[model samples]
Target: RQIRSRFIDEVDSGVVRTETGATITQKADRFSLDESSSPKKSTSATSIEYDWETPVSGKTYKSASGSTIEYDLQDGDDPFQVGVIVEHAKFGPGKIISRTGLGMDAKVVVFFKSRGQKKLMLKAAPLQVIG
Candidate 1:
């Protein structure tokens, strides 16, 4: 009777460790095409800009890097509501963990737990609150 959610799948990286704690690695088929490593070139030179503002909430968001973002519930919410999208200068995007007066904390927290992810700022960062 439960509807499975995609959010659960996004939680961890697919890599798994054995009981001995030795690393396990997987390989995918390798194929090379000329376009595989090619850079995408935009035909149009027009600039696209979006100024997001909420009249009721009085929230504003703007980013120049145009990085992809995602969000999760703010800990206590039920039915898994979406929270704020926390962007970083170097650590990329992550889910907001807790909220404070200044801003919210986010943890990238991948299964592999990259060094950068551990060092990623989990306390104060600019956030875009959404439903």
Candidate 2:
């Protein structure tokens, strides 16, 4: 007998598709050492595979002043400027509430419309500034 399962693991802008398969084999009753014993127990083994991908984070947004700005977050750069408008693929639009630390250790707190507040790492978070 065989069993299979599949699922998607998502974190910020990154996504992983996981698939797993298991196979089980039972011994015939005649092969059992004791004729009166229950059917021989079987062990099942599972194999798993994953496919990962990351989508683009944010886009260039134009403000009311007609000025264009780039809002995407990049590694080794400070992306969180307090009070800036930013958008997250999963959390929608939000505003930067506060920020702490520097470089890869930097963290930003954002308040979203649908998801409320969230704290994210600057380098790993899938966030983009809108204004």
RMSD of each: 18.5, 16.0
RMSD score of candidate 2 (Å):
16.0
Report the poorest 10 consecutive residues by lDDT, candidate 2: 8-17
Worst 10 residues of 1 by lDDT: 36-45
Candidate 2 C-alpha lDDT tens digits along 3-116: 322211112111221122222222432211222322332222343332223323465655434546554656534446788899987799999999997544568999998999
Model 2 Cα shift for residue 88 (angstroms): 0.7
Model 1 / residue 5 / CA error / Å: 50
- Name the regions of candidate 1 deviating beyond 4 angstroms: 1-82, 102-131
For each candidate, what is the lDDT? 0.32, 0.57
Write down the TM-score of every candidate. 0.20, 0.40
